[model samples]
Target: MKAAFLVPVLAALWPAPALSDGVAGEFDYYILSLSWQPAWCRTTGDGRDAPECQNGSGRDFVVHGLWPQYERGWPDHCETRERDPSRRDTQAMGDLMAPGLALYQWRKHGRCSGLSAAGYYAALREAAEAVRTPAVFDDLPRDIALPPAVVEDAFIEANPGLTADGITVTCKAEALAEVRICLTRDLEPRACAPDARRDCARSRVLMERIR
Candidate 1:
């Protein structure tokens, strides 16, 4: 009788598991964002003291994130049972993105991936590797002004399967900012969602020279 009473008391005292705001691993696709380091340095990183902005960092197009997306919207900060990545795990991604961004991406986007931290990062690496950066941007000797379409064309030309609708170029403060590419859940190139297909319309947007 005493043992039965204790069971009831314990059940009353224990906390219920927290409910996740968004379901994990249920997104329709992914958006792989690549940031132009020079443009970022000139516009934002100049104030943040980011290592990518330091002289000789030699970074051009750097991984921004691999975000899960819906056909109409996107998920963020979803709760998950998987353990958070350790410092070492975030640091390992420094070659592709900043350690701080890696941690933030894991908290905001990675949690919704349904995979454990290790699996999410591995998938991120694979997704980035699947896309090829246009070689024309490499060692660009001087700043140039061009339509955003030109940048998109360069990317589509470099990656055979990537089409006009599969990628979008974004500009910031009249400068080239990022190139966002849509991919299938399995990492194949695909047309972007209507919302994701909003390309920057800036004609003669400045693309800063590589630092």
Candidate 2:
């Protein structure tokens, strides 16, 4: 799901009472969004450096952004304009996300996170590393057809405690888009919000190969 970013004036429009959890430290949980590199590159027709398109980048599932979410809704652009990640950090995570996305994630979602910029990205790295990718996704076959349920089950089988309810398979047209995984603040698999769950009814979705 696309995260909503509220401007400072507009952000204040929602009262503190309406705001969920501690100012930042205590969001309900986290949404570790794993975007399919091939799907994005193929569908959007543009991405990061030549290495990523050439398959030299080792990452299969790229970090879309680690968003801090409320059970019912979410927040964005929490920090004032003064707050930004250091250049070193921006450079470090540049490849993990596409160009501009690293800084964009920090400015939009990461800053709202009670965690500091370094800590937020560190948590993101840990979360991404901890989840084991199913072999099929690791070396995706071109245009391979599979039900969304099959994709969810593959993740459930590979990761302990993860259930179909906690995994949402997002699609773009007929192409597999992303696997949005639900995680507790402590980074454990938790059931996703009913609204956040996948509602796509296609019988089969195509998994684009990362060539």
List the candidates' TM-scores in order.
0.86, 0.80
Q: How many clashes (backbone atoms < 3 Å, residues ≥3 apart in a chain or on different chains) does model 1 have? A: 0
Over 4 Å off, model 2: 1-22, 46-50, 55-59, 80-82
Per-residue lDDT of 74 in model 1? 79
**lDDT (Cα, tens digit) per residue for candidate 1, span 89-194:** 9888876766677777788789888888888899888988878888888767889888999999998999989999999888776887778999998989999998
lDDT of 1 at 104: 78
Writing each residue's lDDT as its tens digit, candidate 2 over 10-105 gives: 110112333433355646777787766666556443433334445534345656767777886777777543457777886787545543667777
Candidate 1 clashing pairs, residues 3+ apart or interchain: none
> Going through the candidates in order, what is the number of backbone clashes in each?
0, 0
Give lDDT for model 2. 0.66
Alpha-carbon deviation at 129 in model 1, angstroms: 1.3
Q: Tell me the RMSD of model 2 versus the true structure.
A: 6.8
Model 2: residue 125 alpha-carbon error in angstroms = 0.8
Maximum-lDDT candidate: 1
